[model samples]
Target chain A: MTAKTTKFVQGNEACVEGALYAGLDFFAGYPITPSTEIMELLARRLPANGGKFIQMEDEIASMCAVIGASLTGRKVLTATSGPGFSLKQEALGFAVMAEIPCVIVNVQRGGPSTGNPTHVAQGDVNQARWGTHGDHAIVALTASNHQDVFAMTVEAFNIAETYRTPVILLLDEVVGHMRERLTVPEAGAIPLVERLRTSVRKGVDYHPYLPRDDGRLPMSDFGGVHRYNVTGLFHDMWGFPSDNPGVVHGLIRHLMDKIENNAHRLAHYKTYHLQDAETVLISYGSAARSALHVTENLRARGERIGLMELQTLWPFPAEQVARECGHAKQVVVVEMNTGHMCQMVRAALGPPARVFLANRMDGVLITPTDIKAHLRLIAGRGV
Target chain B: MSVQDYIRERFFPHIWCPGCGHGTVLNNLVRAVETLGLDKNEIVMVSGIGCSSRIAGYLDFHTLHTLHGRALAFATGVKLSRPELNVIVPMGDGDALAIGGNHFIHAARRNINITAIVMNNRIYGMTGGQFSPLSGEATTATTAPFGTIDPDFDTVALATAAGASYVARTTTYHVQEIRKRIAEAIVHPGFAVVEVMSQCPTYFGRKNKQGDAVEMLRRYKEGTVPLDKQPADPEKIPRGVFVQRERPEYCKRYEHLVQAAMTDGAALT
Candidate 1:
């Protein structure tokens, strides 16, 4: 392994550093709470690193700019919170439909609409998956700490480039503000993924959306000789708008299959003490930290409990959740929202596992004490 | 290459209705690009949702047909990411002024090197006949059957005040003038606005007693005054170059900053 240097950094700061290491050179964002630091840091560092940063007028424009930059063969990034993320949904859909590669960091705060600006919440879990309209696929990852934030930012870019789709790096206010020691990996140590550009001669034989044998289309830069169209409308392989049912159906299915077929490769999680546990705690993001602490304490007291911390939230990772929590007598889903992922866990675990929710949505972290209380209740039921 | 070579013929017969002035505007735009001898591969035509925005599909350039009023934001990204390409945006009156008003002003304020062509037809033609920000007061539209109380926007004035380096206005009736203005806007080296007063005979003309396409074209010829022949009445639409001044373009300034940062050894962190 290459030598690395450890430095004290906030989660948000580590996100920017990680993006730079991932070869990000274009950033377009509008400042919002719990996520503004990512944009501010990028503004200062991007120019120095031979990258570009633009503060757009609003979240919509910021998202649009990110998509535009990505089309020109640059790794682009943007960060926002609850309300800003909502404003970015339309353009986010644009990126999804156009198959642009970019990363969006949503340092989530409490919200139905501006519920709490400086507090932690994973309320955007569902929004990140289904925020945009229509039938489309997405990849989202949640980071629980400063180091995880750095590592996941790099992974977010790689996943986006590999799939040619937008990846949401979901963080909560607590992880964003909390500072910790994070190791800066040596240059070229962390694996990087670059977009596949068209190798077909420019004017000779090129169609923008023509898929390769692997089912992913190679993108061309806007100014490159291989000029072609990009549109939000349902398009044929030539990238021009088409209302033909066969073309429309093929386009949508290809987009979905590209991610769904590769779900096994993208699904990621961490398990603790699952070897002989009878109860499993299913949690993610900041809430996972609490669950892990609770699991360790309960195990010390000789309770057969384990923790399954999910890092990749979307493509739901149902198979992994089922395999890990299938045999448990009880499965408790700990989250900062009112049963967003809990519903998915239930669907994944099915009837026999007896899924239960341990949630807190009042802009406060779900503490170990609360999770322990839930575990005690489950144990008392004596399944 | 011939003008026919620049057209995406497979996507045509064009969508514009008979007598629609947007066809003329499109024709002028094509001629303008042709006059400058720009390679089709090096140009990007971006458009928002409107009848005019459909031109992006019919052009063989690198085009983006984006959301209603968000074309400028998307084009800004394309231009900044690859400054070597010439980016042009075509927007309707409602698309540019009603929904995309903020982006319009900000893009001009930045003075980025992109040419914006506003097809000011004075009404929302694509969505039927709704009153737009540029619809003349007292004009009857579907949403304003009793005559509109809302004031119309002077697109040229707004763009000029917003810091665009080049601003000009011409009617679709003045085909040669529109083509000349579009070419000038493209070569301006900074943010440029060319407001083409296009006629929506299907909506605005039918609603206002402006007769058919021919009558509306005749009215355009008779109603508008040249900038030198200014009438005392402020309502008269004057046609000419309203603003042209030199300033460093946004992308150039960004490049200079990048160069300085690289040479000074100033780390971003």
Candidate 2:
């Protein structure tokens, strides 16, 4: 009972703890089921902690508000689900264009358009990458348990501040609603990344979009002496809107390269018993839990199978995935979506025939049995 | 500092057309801020996408040129997060009343301390001539070749009904009043709306056969009656502060809530 570090909480609640731990100074969100608990808890906790929390009139407003708050040099975020995520796509794009650091948590329920509210699906894997119009790069993280959820939530903020770009925390229903024990990490144990502020004095001109030698752009608070522009248009170093072809081209490439060039560093995942394996199962989010369970069960029976649980979905870790699963004779991706992550795995491995999918879309969580069935079929051993 | 000191002189020549009233608004806004003696570092001008929205680009304060019809929403976040900052939002007619209408009413209802300037030029100038929410029943535009059927929103009435503590209306013709009203709106402690009947000579005027900027201003002088000189005719647009009363500001109220939470809620380690 030494300070009781472990506490039982839902995935949504764990996320709140992680955000507060990450020094979230402002949060603006709209209520959407499967994600409402995040805002609800923050509404009470944020004010008490001297952080600002607002329930905006709608999803778009919530996203816009967070972006504005972020410009003022405050760490900001917003939480939503499928339909709400769609509403936020425009503002999300604005965040990308402006290079404002903020976090957006999409506790994805079923979708194409409001497919299910109480069920789980990894359907937003592609949406998180391509939902916002135009070509832009995004960092999306996911986890299968409360501890990982807590950790990834903190990482989302760190990554956002580091890149001066918005990070998406995509959680599915199963992990979001499931209650589990999470031991909160002691402060300073996981080093926090504060946004690098401009060192130039008040009289000197501060370039808001100018990158340093290490590729990180420093920022100035809205109330600071360096009063400059922040716009959604392709801008010069001064942050003013520009239509010049050179400026426009440089910006698009820069935005894409900032995250893509660093994909190796941005990738996050866990490998289990994959030193030497004949069959590999690639998965992430809530579905990875079942995949890990099946991997352990089949290993006990002396079958050479392993699990690779991916945390980074966007700037999809293509190189690491290809390198990790390259030795496997058969790779099966287990998830609750229609082969979304499976397609990425196949693309990484370069042959669809060797890769298989174990998926459930009937609002049921994929279990060990379901994954085992896919492995049996993929191994050419008919049950 | 002079009005020029508050502006980014590099980007001008400016973007507005020769007779576009948004320039007048930008000119007067600089004067208003200068008159109030507000520090430029303390000011944050946020604007939505439109002809008027470009006002943030010309002035030198911390500016956020945001998405269409979402200026107030962005300003709400900026003001509420940093209560010490002065947040001003200048939106176009369609930008505030059409796609951004919900945000407009809610921001007013919250009585947040942000000055909202609605430059009502009945047609959409940025996207060429299109009938706006402010284009009354008979106005013709590129979109409404046969004349519009949409009724215009009464900016004063809407702001007043939506709980804005300071609601005022003026025309681009009244250059002095623009400075007076905007300065007053900035000084007001609660939500304030100044609906400037700004003329869009390039689009709204040409489409409506209202001559040029000069003719439009001539019409504004004849059309609007002052509050002190109350006219019986309902057709005359009234120009002056219509609603200026005290209500707790949103950011101030939030501060009180934060204080209460800190004093009474379970303490965090």
Candidate 3:
């Protein structure tokens, strides 16, 4: 009911609209393939909306700049593709270590290193979860269509603000470039998470890294009345670098536990004909689009096929995934990358033998027919 | 306000080796802010990793100790977002000219209002005295046991070529000059670079047999001449403000751009 005005736009454009809707105050990014439109649109859009945008020299600077803006109590974002994302990993880890809130969009393209610039790939799935070196936790989200692209982009910012961590929005080249209809929601329709600034008095001590009773760390604006230090070193509650054994152990644990503990609550997905399906298809990003197409076509012929489209990829919802696929006779994990999500899907389920993968890696969108062939094989028929 | 009022006293018993010139540079910076009477809450001190980078932590302001060679990039974001706030970045020799060289030039190119203080110790002391980009040829370092072959970068020259509105150089021995240059840089409204030639006596001195901290300070006084000294000799390092001129700062230009862009957005709607 809140869908206000409908327009046809690319997924990247929808992401830009969603960021403004989420009250983005600052953005700094370097342009790369597939993800360039997001930065290009924001470059033109931010200034008019009374926000700030900068095209930094490179991806590393872009990531560092957003973290800097976020400390000044601004909601910030940066977008990049595969190679750019790789360049951003160190600074992204710095954001996590310093507990700064911001969003990073990797409109994923092929490559371990510049393999394909204009082609789609979901190969960075594992990279998002463990790209930054250290035993730290991360939040990664994705969407399969233009509408979900808009919603998930907003959700990514919300998660960043609430958790005080960097949130990655993963969209493949196909989803990023594909134009589709999206209904822009009414302003204030979807709730937003505002930054929680400290209530400590101006002259009083403000701990920049201390979490209160409910695991929420209230932050003081970087240039605000309270003067405090922010650093990448293992730090005390006062935000000063500390190498004490207790301090280092406690800080890393808190960073990991904060998001990992709330993974189930953060899990988001959509089910199509899942209630009574015998064959379940698990997919995310743009691959879910093909999976849904395959499910609907098979369902029209009286087959019990279902599609589970995931929105939250990291802090992956293992328990819920196991439960959803518990009753299904066979589970097929579909993706563009060969076995990234398939491995996770197998881990989430009890009988890994029933879990299979339907995938493509030639810079092509997985088709409905491509999925049906997997189903025919699963039904003990020749491919 | 007293000069002590500018420092975070709790962080005292600071993390510098004995006779390290970085402490002197820190002292000069503190007095400079005190002279300006800038509100402690309005100053954001950012620094990249190195011995001199620790100055950000000792300052009682909004401090950010960021990744190596990236302080200027981070400071650019901070100052551009809140142009009214005074942002200062203190970086070490290699931190500034080597890893962070690109950011330094670009920040100067944008002419964003930021005071970049390069504490030039001429060696990478924190990681145990490796030869830095600014270490110059014939300098002895841990990485350059046979003496370095890499040439030094003239900070003033690099900053001037990068379009900085203000460029100056001072040494730790000239403590008063360091303070004066910092105060002048702060009041200037565009990108300003102040390179202070602080000594790393423990490494750059002992490795090259340049004697103790006091001897190094004496050499600073004897080696460099004032910029206006009559004969402009090629042998001596000249010390003074190199460039000071006016230009529209990056943030103010963006503000005017926003005013025009609002009209552009309205037309689109």
DockQ: which candidate is best?
Answer: 3
lDDT of 2 by residue, B1-269 (tens): 88889889887777888888988898899999888899999999999998898899889999999999999999999999898999999999999999999999999999999999999998889999999888999899998999998888888899999999999999999999999999999999999999999999999899889999999999999999897776675678889999999999998889999898888667533
lDDT of each: 0.90, 0.91, 0.91
Against the native complex, each candidate's DockQ, computed on alpha carbons, is 0.77, 0.73, 0.78
* Model 3 lDDT, full chain set: 0.91
How do all models score by TM-score? 0.97, 0.98, 0.98
Query: What TM-scores result for chain A when each predicted structure is judged separately against the true chain A?
Result: 0.97, 0.97, 0.98
Q: Write the per-residue lDDT of candidate 3 for residues B1-269, one digit (tens) a residue.
A: 78788888887889999999998888888888889888998999999999989999998989999999999889988987898999999999899989999899999999999999999989999999899989899999999899998999999999999999999998999999999999999999999999999888889999989899999999899889889882666678899999999988999999998998898986632
lDDT tens digits by residue: candidate 1, A4-100: 8788988899898899889998999998999999988887788888888899989999999888888888999999999999999999999889999
Q: After superposition on all CA atoms, what RMSD does each candidate show versus the true structure? A: 1.8, 1.5, 1.4
What stretches of model 2 exceed 4 Å from their correct place? A1-4, B267-269
Q: Which ranges in model 1 have alpha carbons more than 4 Å from their true place? A: A1-3, A381-383, B231-235, B263-267
Residue lDDT tens for model 2, A1-383: 12337889999999998998889989999989899999998988888888898989999999999999999889998999999999999999999999999999999888778789888888888989999999999999999999999999999999999999999999989899999999887777788999999899979978988778777888899998899999998899998878999999988989998999999999999999887988888999999999999999989999999899999998899999888888888888898889888888888889543888889988789899888777777667975
Of 1 and 3, the candidate ahead on DockQ is 3
Worst 10 residues of 3 chain A by lDDT: A344-353
Q: Can you give the lDDT of residue B21 in candidate 2?
A: 91
Worst 10 residues of 1 chain A by lDDT: A374-383
